[model samples]
Target: MSTQVPPIHSTAAAPMLELRGVHTHIGAYHILHGVDLTVPRGQLTMLLGRNGAGKTTTLRTIMGLWQASQGRVLLGGEDITRLPTPAIARQSVAYVPENMGIFADLSVKENLLLAARQARHAGQMDEERLQWIFGLFPAVQKFWNHPAGKLSGGQKQMVAVARAIVEPRDLLIIDEPSKGLAPAIIHKMIAAFEQLKAAGVTILLVEQNLAFAKRLGDSVAVMDNGRVVHAGRMADLAADTDLQQSLLGLAL
Candidate 1:
């Protein structure tokens, strides 16, 4: 039987975020099954899989949304497996979930302020950081005074992503970025992520859009049945039609 040995960077620089055989349960039912994944320093790694493959759950596990039932979650090589959600947020990790989680009544500035307040440890995020965020997604600047509730779907999505890393994070976990958006809007969002990556943000992206994933991913992990089934360089997978068809059930 041929098995793909997922290439894990065994270096000492320390991964920005990592999950070692993580297991999680929601309510009375267990979900994640021994998931192992890692995000190297300054790398844009993608967790790609179809629905129900535990992609979002994996992101939740890292963000301390669900405390791992087993295994370890490390932020900069320190064990954070038992940390609370708020505590995890303070660990230089930012999470933008599938739902976006925007405060409908809050204005764009208010949303950014909330994230800044929560992340403003040791004067971590200053005016400069906030400006940087606004610059990355200029649309946010235009809607600064506008209430998020009145924003369109694409605008809200931009705000959700902006709020998550407004304070600057060592690691960013983004879930299903391209879901339910016009192709044009998705293109704009893609550029925003590219800017983040170019600025050296280590990202763990959980996305279903294969074409989008190929654009930003330095490496890819295709998950299924709650475990990673295939992992390789994005370029390698992009060229292998058979691998793409067999694992992701996608053409090209």
Candidate 2:
């Protein structure tokens, strides 16, 4: 009913985040069958799967939003499986879900300021960190006074990304960024991710868009029926037509 993933990410070097023998269950459904994944420090790793393949659930389990029924989730050498979502986030993990969290009624600056406030020791929106997000999206600077609900879809996405990174998290988990956007807008999102990667942020992304995934992923894991069947360097996945056709149903 499920396939075992090959040992792809070597342990010669310790990873920034490692999920070993992870098993998760929801109600009567069991997901993440013994999932093993390693996200190396400072590299972008992606999780790919068709709908219902447990990609989004896997991200949720890692975030401890949905506690794993079984497994060890380690982040930068700390065991985080039992930690709460807020604790995990404070430990330097950020998430940008498919529904990019934007306060529709809030101004662009207000939304960003709220996100940055998470890292603030005792305040909301650290001024220095707020400036960094503003710098990253000059458009944000242009729309500081504008309501988020009025911004374009791409601009909303920009707000989402800016919010995730404002606190300078050690790991960023982004889910399905290309779901309903125009190709041009997806490219813009990709470019922003590239900039984040260049800034030395570690990212673990769950993506359905093959073209977009290949472009930013240093490594990839393909999930099928709640199991990881393929894991390897992004370049290997990109060049292997047979693997793609047989396992992923999509070829580069």
Candidate 3:
């Protein structure tokens, strides 16, 4: 059985996700300053920035982990700015945090099981989707019964991502999927993401890996001082070295 996701044309549809003039305050600190971003339907949007530039904060605000002090978050044109985290998640959005949130003590299968809300047990889980995920990350299957804590960093990261896709998701927001990964593992990660893109998942990624970003990103947004300073096609950004230097202080 084919598990291919139906493609949504990137140019013709409204954005899968949008943030307008978003502001977030983490305790006494104001982290985000009116971030405006658009994740086009069925395309991967890379969020690039220097450290502490509020990339992660913007993602968190969209996921409702951090409430926006101002502005709005919209998913499929529905206002979700003030929705609780669970409510937002129920709207078919999946978030993989920078920390790669997973239960260390739980088996890899158990970790994935928790993400399949409609499935109360492994038998009830979607076999086709599980097989599809295994094709993307074999480590998840190889370590199915092993404690997630026992897996290496790359494997754990794989499990984190695999968990997010256990069920079909309309939008996937991942923070640094390539961070702290070995080159070989990063290559596999890139391939998996490419397949995800081909399958028409609308993804927003906060990535410091410019090479990885260039390969998988369809659209690019560069953040600095808590605001997006540049937004355009990934190819345009990749082809312009001076623009890369100005926005990111480095070439792709």
Candidate 4:
């Protein structure tokens, strides 16, 4: 049998985000067990794992939503594990949770405006960036004054991502942007993500969709039992059906 070690990429490049020996606990039950992963600068890294594998827990820990009982979370070589959520956000990290996190009562414009921390009002927002976001997700522009709850599922997903990138961010972390979307919408999302990557936005995504992961991921990490069981280039994993089946429990 051939030995398989977690593959590392772009060693010359410093990681925009790193987790070292991270552990998380919720009440008496332990969730994460010493997870170590790295997300390279200007690259899209995908986090994959089956249900109950602590994928979401890892992201929550990074966001400071759930305090890590142990370990270090680093961004640009700075330790941010202990920082508060607002402090983490101030560092230019945008997290879009699986639930989409949109205010049902707010207008689409209001949602994007709220995400621009420096802008107190719609007019104060950076017009160029807003235009770019509109170009990326046109639903946001088409439904500017419409209540968010009135939009369709795919439109709401677009709005959620639009809100995240309403301003320049050092890192964009999203959980399952393709979840519950039609094939056409997922294709559009893949294109949007490609554009974001081309523009040099670092992305960390937790996705159950293998096609989505294979399409946008520059680097990939697969978690199992609350630990990273495999890490490598997305292309490497995509080309190896056997490895995919072993790590993800099914071939892509």
TM-score of every candidate relative to the true structure: 0.89, 0.87, 0.94, 0.94
Write candidate 2's Cα lDDT for 124-168 as tens digits: 566776676666666677887799999887788878888788777
Clashes of 1: 0
Cα lDDT tens digits, model 4, 1-252, are 966634334233558999999999999989899999999999999999898899999999999999999888888777888999999999989999999999989999999889988999999999999898888888889999999999999999999999999889889999999999999999989999999999899999999999999889999999999999999899999999999999988987
**Total clashing pairs in model 2:** 1
Q: Over 4 Å off in model 2, which ranges?
A: 1-13, 118-136
Candidate 1 lDDT by residue in tens digits, 43-123: 889898878998988888887877789888878878888899999888778888898999999888888778886554424
Candidate 2, residue 235: Cα displacement in angstroms equals 0.3
RMSD to native for every prediction? Answer: 5.2, 5.0, 7.4, 5.6
Sort the candidates on TM-score, descending order.
3, 4, 1, 2
lDDT of 3 by residue, 135-230 (tens): 889999999999999999999999999999999998899999999999999999999888888888899999998999999999999999999999
